[model samples]
Target: MNADIKLRVSNIDKSFPGVKALNQVNFAVRKGTVHVLCGENGAGKSTLMKVINGIYRPDAGEILIDEKPVDIKNPIQARSLGISMIFQELNYIPEMTIEESLCVGNWPRDRYGRINWKEIRKRTKELLAKENLNYNPETKLKELTVSDIQMLEILKAISYNSDIIIMDEPTSAITNKEVEVLFQKINEIKSRGACIIYISHKMDEIFRIADEITVFRDGCVVDSRPIGEYDLETVISQMVGRKLENNFPKEEIKLGGEILKVQSLTQKDKFEDVSFHVREGEIIGFAGLMGAGRTEVMRSLFGLDPYESGEIFIKNQKTVIKNVKSSIDKKMVMLSEDRRRFGIIPVRSIKENVALASLRKFIYSGRLHEEEENKAVKEFCEKMNVKAPDFETKIESLSGGNQQKVILAKWMVTDPDILIVDEPTRGIDVGAKYEIYKLMTELAKQKKALVMVSSELPELIGMCDRIYIMSKGKVTGMLTRDEFTQESIMAYATGTKIQKEVK
Candidate 1:
């Protein structure tokens, strides 16, 4: 029963109609320790977390606090019992102030049931400082950038005085600077005798902050060990049930035709002089740390953002693309990094989101072919292995990995010649990541040019045929399969050099 454990998730099982989301999962978090949860997609990591945080009630098993059995009925119940969670997907009222978000459901009330504004603001201010975060409690969420919103979520969790905190890829969208601040805050919270259930795919971040590690694979716990008991290789093997020999495929393909060539691509403050050429059947990886203007470069290239001076060429012929429509017309599509914000529609069904970009083909004179759309969605779901009861299921109902698969299926259905996947497997589990990697390889086999922007160094080395390292809006160095090394990429990404030749 793990009597000393602050939170014990015992023999939990949960399922949807067609998929067993979680099966007999047991997890625990010791008091005042950073317990990391590692798993491949479909492993039930999120489901287990959802159970603990009262987002989902398990069909079987019980959760215990200090060796006593307790059933978590809802989020409020979990919070009342000193448990809080921050989702990987951010959800907050954009127009609301930071203080408003922190004290919404659990607001301090006066004798007559009136909200105590003074007390709320004071608590908000104190919590933000505890993390060394510099944000006004009155700042609206909408006005702040993605990084700012992430920090606010942490502050809100801290403000609740939660004993156990669950952070699911909390730093996925934040910049490197912001990530440093987040790590500092996490350490501070740990020092203050608070427990954190850290969930992330980023190995460095996991090792840096976690006091102990637990790996989940195929909806089961593989092992739990002290943080230093295993190195990256061992930890990864435990997570996936196999040692990862090649994180990147790094296959050699013939450069028969110049599929895409950018000449002097310039987007005012985003990116400049971003000139590069991608050949048919080649995989070009745009490698950089967070905030290195990688996504900006892809957006500009895809015509989603306005570029001041850039001549794009397809098959050595110049063309002007000023918007998303033109880029699609040119057969180049982007699988956005921010899946929730720019990719999937939460309210829409998986069928609708997948068929969105190319709806015209399925529509005739304002009359839609519902049968055709349904068939297409079903086929794509099968092809991508998107596990759901049916394509009619709301996109939000699917797990993170399934949602990601649906997005990839969306872009692939477009049948584009050039595919730019910005962090395609960012928040997914190890199993899902391998599937994505295989999909990318298949794309290369079909002679389609691919541009991948990734934060994980191993992924870049494993998947890319040739890697271009970017640092602060500029190309720093290019590495071939043989020269694909993390230190080399980090050296360039950190701006230790302008441009260097790799031997």
Candidate 2:
């Protein structure tokens, strides 16, 4: 064991019923450095992290802390050993106050052993202040946005003062400014001789924050080297085991008649007077900052939320979509940005989740036709390139990318004319992202109107025929492909410049 090594795992092997999650894996992290793990989804990155965090027990492995072997039976034990993890999924209880959520395991106590609410609030306020979060400590988690919850999770993990911290896609939902703050915090942690084991699919984030890079594939270690020794191309090739010629496989498709149109969509305190349209075979993007009302607009369009004053026209017919069913009936479907919350039925099997929305298609005489439903699920799963042991497998067992693929398959079963995808490639690896882009291209080729909401500027530029930018609940600018640029998008997104409309 090296003196500088903070944590090490030897010959780690883990398995599920039909999956070999980790195989003879050997990994180590040194003090005062960011060690990044890069791999495709279901390639054992999260599995290995779970093992370290004691959320999962390895069938065969030895974990060492400071050169001494130890058995970590659970998360509490791991935390006690100065090991903390910020999970990819936000796990805070929505009903709990920020102060209570932050002090879950280590609550401050008075002389009589009662919880000291004053001390808890004081501590939470200080922590929030240190992170530059302006939220009230008494605010409930349910009131916060996904990005806000993500930032709080980071703060909670850091508050543990751990020697080894595991961050899995910490920047997946946060804004660029918050990402900068997170990077600064990472540097401060490094200065204090702490080790960081980071897992992210984002190439830029990897190159920017990593001191060393380790690539995983099929539950095995492929390569580990210092950041200086690898470039973007090399790291990506190592991750997917092949060279990717193009990150965005956008295709040209002939535009057809306008299929969906929104006029004067307004939701109080959310978004106001937002107007956008997508023609058949056209992919229109919504680009903006985190709270710029992009997601809110999509939610409203999909009937997941209400818009006070909006006229929705489908194929030139005024359609009233007051709920999700109405939206679906109008040949429209949405893939939400928060997949776990709005997209997936986690406890259900992949087949069930896929067939959920389109169950009517499989029902014959008030009974589900199993054979027909199975056939459709199988076809779409294959079309989406979903990697799973079986359709009967629980959807939660699949990786984030595979889960997303299943969700896409779910909506595709409906054969909708309009598809609204929010952050479609979020938290997925580069290879998966490429596949999704290809799928989107294919969908456009099929003359299905696609409305994409994404924070990544390059993604919108590459895939969208035109983009609508929003800032502070207003449509700031609309740009065609030729005008798409990060500088221009940011100018619109930040309210530095605005255009009422662009055609």
Candidate 3:
């Protein structure tokens, strides 16, 4: 109950159908300190954050603000009590402009009792400038990229002037440079005596910014201690309820002939003269910084984007893939990086989503085979270890990792020979990431070609047989396993060393 304690939750309990999300959880944060929460997906970290922010009222618990017991019934109430949050999933009005979204609930008023448009623009410009973002105040929210939106949300939380700030995976979609800027801002906020409850699955960030560490496992608090008291191994062991044997369980598969080849692929301003190839039973990686055209090239390859001049060969045969259907017909599949936007249908059941592309296989006698479709969906979901109440549940109800698993199920149902996964583990926990890596390895062993695009260089170095570094719209460097290094990749990604020939 000391004043130095900025926020506290005692005996917090929350539950949903078929899941006890939180069980008598206890957490506290001191003023000016960064308190980090680490846990596997569905281990009650996100649920706890929701409870603290009043999105979900604890079934039995007490919340204290500066040692004073208070009931927070809604997010508005939590904000009024000097609480602000940056959610992992964006919750902004896409139809609105950046200025409008930032000014939500706290718009400056004019003397004539009207919304102050000019003041809103000024504040938005100031916030953008503070973060070194080059976004127009009048730009629609939907027009901004994922990283830009994340930076804007961080700026919004900082502008709240709150005593307690909850950041849920704030750096998940940002670049390393952006993360450094965010850490600097966090230090500045700490100097002003604010409490930051930081939640993330990334160990490096946790160790860098956390003053106190709390680990959650299976809805219970595993341990809490000073950051110095916990090593990386101890933290990982506590998070998954067991020691993580290997972060990347990559399998060495027998090499085969090229399964996919692209020559002189040009997507106008997005990417130009892009060239790459993936061989059977091999895992190829595309490594680059943001805006380096990795995703753009993948989109073109998957037929989600149009290219002006390019030649694509599938299994030594020239093909014209002008749309997703053609790409699928050619036995190629893609898992989009932005799952919410292009991967899953939120309102649809898992069965429908999983069987979406391969529904033809379930049709017989001019009728839809409902039972067969359900059976196929179940098979793929189980193979991916998708943890959900049932296939009947809506896709949106699952956690990010589980949703990602379902997407994998959805694509694998197509029985594609070539798989392209973009940012496969962007927002997933370490435990789930290991599972995904295992799945990718299994696919490789099965002779399915894979092209994985990731911004994390360590992931490339860990799981890839070879890496192709992209910069500005070109493939700058290609490295074999022995040639892989973070420094070498960055050198090519930043155009410092582009002497390596394109493969």
TM-score of every candidate relative to the true structure: 0.87, 0.97, 0.96
Q: Looking at model 2, report the run of 10 residues with the lowest lDDT sum.
A: 244-253
- Model 1 per-residue lDDT at 362: 83
Deviation in Å, model 2, residue 209 alpha carbon: 0.9
lDDT of 3 by residue, 473-503 (tens): 8989899999998999999999899954587
lDDT of 2 by residue, 1-503 (tens): 59989999999999998999999999889999999999998899888999999999999989999989989999999999999999887666779998998999888999999999999989998998887778899899889889888888898999899999999889988988889989999999999999999999989989999999999999999999999999999999999999986657887788999998899889999998888888999999999989999999889888888889988899999998899999998889999988877888889999999999999888879798999999999998997778888999999888777888899899999899999999988877888787788888988999999999998888899899999999999999999888888999999999999995644
Q: Per-residue error at 103 for model 2, in Å? A: 1.6
Evaluate model 1: give its TM-score. Answer: 0.87
| Model 1 ranges with Cα > 4 A deviation | 1-3, 97-99, 108-140, 217-247, 363-380, 500-503
Ranking by TM-score: 2, 3, 1
lDDT of 1 by residue, 120-231 (tens): 9998888878666788889888777676777777667765768889998788778788788778767777877778998888777888888999988767788888887978
lDDT of each: 0.82, 0.90, 0.88
In terms of TM-score, which candidate is strongest? 2
lDDT of 3 at 65: 87
